[model samples]
Structure formats: structure tokens, C-alpha cells
Target: MNRLYHESEDWVAQGSCRQYDPELFFPVSTTGPGLHDAELAKAICRGCAVRRECLQWALRAGEPHGVWGGTTPEDRRYMRRDLPLPAAS
Candidate 1:
């Protein structure tokens, strides 16, 4: 799939989550205790310099799970509703 940003931009390398456990961004559930993990992930994202790039990438890729760009899968679903469809290659 095409990326929303150039590879050389390397935004992923700058995410605040880089210093945390990868599992923290992939909560088992969005409810109950899993919600706590999600919140923690969001806290990290809040301070990330590449947050907008990460979120736009996730939305363009139709990411279906995990916390991305400080947003849950459900959150992206709602956000995707108003996005323009990507052009066919």
C-alpha cells in the first residue's frame, strides 16, 4: 500500500511509544482494564512529535486494531467516515 508520508521522513522512529512496551499500544480490549492501557498509550502519543503523521497513516491503511495515533480502532472508524477515499493506483 502507498504511504501518506515519505519513507525518509521516518516519523515512526520518533514516536514517544518507542521507549515503551509495544504491547502497551495493543490492548486486549477497549473496555475494562484494557482501557487503562489504551489511555496510557494515548498519554505517550500526546507528547509524540509525529502523532499527526502516525494517525494519518493508520487511517489511510485502514488499521483495524490497536491504539494508533492515540486513537483506538473504533475511533478511527468514526474518523474514517468523513475521509475522502484514496485514489486507485
Candidate 2:
């Protein structure tokens, strides 16, 4: 997998959630608490300029946790199922 960190356009470094608790994005709550936390994290993503790239990075890395790119782990799983498989080398 390629790393976007070294690129000049990487916006994740400037994410607003950077100052918040990491656990906020990895909420263990499956009820109202979790939902609320997820929303908070997503609120940050909604205004992020690098939201798409952050999401793609998480998907490619098979990130198993967190509300990355404004999506929950389950959301990313659904997305993964819809992605086209890479061609064999």
C-alpha cells in the first residue's frame, strides 16, 4: 500500500479531531453513547478537506476500528464489499 503522509496535499495532518480523544473515534458504545460519539467524530470529517483520502487510506489499510473518514467500521466493511478487486499482476 502507498503512504499519503509524505505528500504535500495530505490534509489528515490538519484534521480538527487531532486534539480530541482518540477513543472518541473508536467508541465501544453500541447504543446512544456510541452513536453520539460517532456523530461527533463525523462532524469533524464532514468539514475535512481530506475526508476522501482519509477514508480511502483506512479502507486500503483494512482499518478494523474507529470512525475514519466519517464512517464507522461497519460502514467501511460495506464499502469494501462494493469495491472492485485489483487486477492480478
Candidate 3:
């Protein structure tokens, strides 16, 4: 994938991302299914607080799995290519 997975020390929870949910057992639901799950992931992301931060981290670091904040790896790919990426926090 186009994601760059790396850790960020400045990850502020602009909102809740399932990425860090200890209660989460399985990967975000998009791994197996097609973009259907990606759409679902986006819906779940609707209320996320740190969605931007998570997206930036993913784009800058090329995160590859699960949902970051709210957006998926594919979403990050589009955003990174389309929008101006934020600096690492």
C-alpha cells in the first residue's frame, strides 16, 4: 500500500480512533472485504476527534493497516495526494 506506518509522539486525540482501542481485537473491518468496509470505516470515523492528526500521521508515515482516527489507508492515500499534508506534530 501507499501508507507509511510509523509511530508518532505528538499524536493528540483530536477524537477517538479505533486504532488505539485496546478493546479492539480484530483489524479494522476493511481488510478482507472491498471498499464496502472502507465506506463503513468512514462512517465510523464520522465522530472521530483526532481524525486529521491520525490522517496526517498515516500520510506522512505511510501507515498501512487499520483505521487511523477515522480514515482508512486508501483514504489517506487520496488525501495525501490531494490535500496539503500537515507537518508531523
Candidate 4:
């Protein structure tokens, strides 16, 4: 198995986005035409089998840009606000 797969990121290989351009998930903006791009990405994510895993990963990693798991950066930021901060080490 690939190192990435061994690390448990294998679900990425099953994502519907694989059939499309990666740029579709990294729109330049979040308004106007970018909104359309985001919607397109979300459409792809909606049918993905690993969407929940993708979203969880993005949230945990504090991903700062692009679309993930059918959600835009702004969407994730809002969602993060509702989550408790990590405990101190």
C-alpha cells in the first residue's frame, strides 16, 4: 500500500473529485464567480463517500483555504467557531 494509504488517508482515493480538475476545489475567491466554483465543488462532494472524513480532516488540520467536504473556507471557519478549542498539551 502507498504510504499515504497506510496513514489512513486512503479515502482520498475514493473521492469523487478525483475525476475532476483539482482547481475546481481551489476557487480564487468566495464571491461572484467563485461562488459558482464552490457550488460546483460542493456538488461533487455531495456524492462523495468520504465527505465526512474529508471535513473532519480539514477541520482538524485548520485548513485555511479552498473547499473541502462540500464546504468553503468561510463555511469551515464558522463551523470551527462552534467547536471547543483543543486542550493544552
The C-alpha TM-scores of every prediction are 0.80, 0.73, 0.50, 0.81
Model 2 Cα lDDT, one tens digit per residue, 29-79? 535668788878878878877788888878888988788788788778878
Models ranked on TM-score: 4, 1, 2, 3
What C-alpha lDDT values do all the predictions have?
0.76, 0.72, 0.53, 0.77
- Among these predictions, the greatest TM-score belongs to 4
Cα RMSDs, all models: 8.4, 8.4, 8.3, 7.7
lDDT for each residue of candidate 1 in 6-57, tens digit (9 for 90 to 100): 3455686677776788788889987787988888887888888988998988
Error of 4 at 48 (Å): 0.5
- Runs off by more than 4 Å, candidate 1: 1-9, 83-89
Q: Looking at model 1, which ten-residue stretch has the lowest summed lDDT?
A: 1-10
Give candidate 3 misplaced runs (Cα > 4 Å): 1-15, 18-37, 83-89
Give the C-alpha lDDT of model 3: 0.53
TM-score of 1: 0.80
Off by over 4 Å in 4: 1-8, 83-89
- The 10 consecutive residues of candidate 4 with the worst lDDT sum are 1-10
Model 3: lDDT of residue 27:
47
